[model samples]
Target: MLYQITADGLVLFHLSFILFVLFGGLLVLKWRHLVWWHPPAALWGMAVEFFHLPCPLTDWENHLRHRAGQAGYDGGFIEHYVWPIIYPAGLTPGIQLGLGCVVLLINVLVYLRLWKWRRTD
Candidate 1:
């Protein structure tokens, strides 16, 4: 039971991290100081998706689940959780790459705005 709770907490944290990677730049727009953090996180997020690298968060979550006597899933957190809800067609390599591109595009646009704002200030 404790393991299962831990696994659930990890899943929540993993999801929150993904959200931050995607939109943390918007926070930077407000906080300004967050500029030092969001870009690298966004880049890492894109790299993981583009390279098809395994996320450590997913691995840790799976390990906790297994320790709790639950069967671990075969893919990353998004594939196991978010993809099913958003894209019932299932997750493919192409889709993963596209998602990575989406992340890159979003952060690029956000940072561009940030740059413009800073210059005007």
Candidate 2:
């Protein structure tokens, strides 16, 4: 029971972190106070994907899953989750690079909008 709870918690954590990467910059746009953290965190998130590093959350989740006697996936979490969203077939280098670009571009656009809004106001 404890292992099941822990595994579910870890899965939620992984999913939330993905959300943070995808829309966190918009949060910064809406709340200026979040600006200090969003760019760095978003960049760090992108970098982790670009370099194919296993996130600590992924590691923790895998550990929890292992404890639950489940076999965890081998690739990074994005490859396991986001790839299905972005591509119908399995991931290709072009798709992977595009995903990275999309993440970076989203944050850049969010920051630019914030900058423009700040200047106009």
Candidate 3:
């Protein structure tokens, strides 16, 4: 029971982290100080997707699920939790690279705007 709860918590955390990586630059635009945190996170997020690296959070979630006597899944958090809801097609390397590129592009645009705004100020 405890392990199951922990697994669920990890899934939530993983999803939240992904969201932050995708849009955290916007948050930086508002907070300014968040610039310190968001860029590193965005890079890590992109690296995981672009390089096909395993995310530690997914591993922890699987470990917890196994400890709880649940069957552990084969893939990452997105494959296990997100892919089913959004797309019937399985996740592929091409899709992963595209996601990474999208993340990088969005952050770049946001930061560029922020830089321009700062210069004008």
Candidate 4:
């Protein structure tokens, strides 16, 4: 029970991190200081998708789930959770690369906006 709750919290935190990695630049537009935080996160996010790196959060979640006597899921958290909601088909390598590219593009645009805004100020 405790393990399950912790695992659930981990999932929530993982999702929050993913969202931040994608859109934290928008937040940084307001906070400004988050500029330092977002780039590394965005880079890590891109690397994870582009290289198929195994995230420790997923592993810890799976470990907790197994501890709670639940069957752990295969694949990364996005494949298990987010992919189904976004697309009907399974995530292919090409799709994964595209996703990474999308992240890169979005962050690039966000940073460009930030740069332009700073120049004006």
Candidate 5:
């Protein structure tokens, strides 16, 4: 029971990190020091999607679930959680590419805004 709860908590943290990677640039707009942190996370996030790499968070959660006598899920965090809700179709390379591109586009737009804002100030 404890392991299950911890696994669930990890899932929430993993999801929050994903959201931060996607939108952290906006946060940087408000808090400039976040600029140091967001790039690495955003880059890693994009690399995972673009390169079809597995997220360690998913592996850790699955491990915890198994330890708790629950059936572990296959694939990454997004696959088991976010993808099913957002895309009814099975995940594919094209879909991953699209996801990566979306991340890239969001970061680019946000950073451009930041750049302009800094220039004006």
Candidate 6:
């Protein structure tokens, strides 16, 4: 029972993190503290994609599923839950590199804005 509860919490946190990465900038616009958070979160998101690494959350989910005698997916959560909606097929290295570039570019822009804002003040 304890393990199940912990697994459920992990799943919830994982889902929320996904949402935050996608919509975080919008949230940052309202809460400036969140702006400070954007770069690291963005980096982590891109790293996961670029490296083709399984997120710890996914591992945790799989472990829980296994414990419950449920089947765990072969691919990452993005491949299982998100790929069908966004990506037509399996993810590739080129796509991963592009995703990483996108993350880096966004952080560059954010830092530029932060510098400019600081200079103006």
- TM-score leader: 3
| CA lDDT, candidate 6, residue 92 | 76
Look at candidate 1 and tell me the lDDT of residue 43.
86
**Model 3 lDDT, residue 98, Cα:** 93
TM-scores, in order shown? 0.95, 0.85, 0.97, 0.96, 0.96, 0.73
Rank all candidate structures by their lDDT, best first, as comma-separated numbers.
3, 5, 4, 1, 2, 6
- The model with the greater TM-score, 1 or 4, is 4
TM-score of predicted model 5?
0.96
Candidate 2 residue runs with Cα over 4 Å from true position: 85-88
**Of 1 and 5, the candidate ranking higher by lDDT:** 5
Model 4 clashing residue pairs (backbone): none
Cα lDDT of model 3 by residue, 1-121, tens digit: 9999999988899999999999999999999999999999999999999999999999899899999999999999888899999999999999999999999999999999999999999
* Tens-digit per-residue lDDT, 3-110, candidate 1: 999999998898888999999999999998988888888988999999999999989999999999999999888989998898888788998999999999999898
Between 5 and 6, whose lDDT is larger?
Answer: 5
What TM-score does candidate 4 reach? Answer: 0.96
RMSD for all candidates, in order, please: 0.9, 1.9, 0.8, 0.8, 0.9, 2.8
Which pairs clash in model 2? none
Please give the clash total of every predicted structure, in order: 0, 0, 0, 0, 0, 0
Residue 86 in model 3: shift from native, Å? 1.2
Residue 100 of model 5 has an lDDT of: 96
Q: Estimate the overall C-alpha local distance difference test score of candidate 2.
A: 0.78
Better of 2 and 3 by TM-score: 3
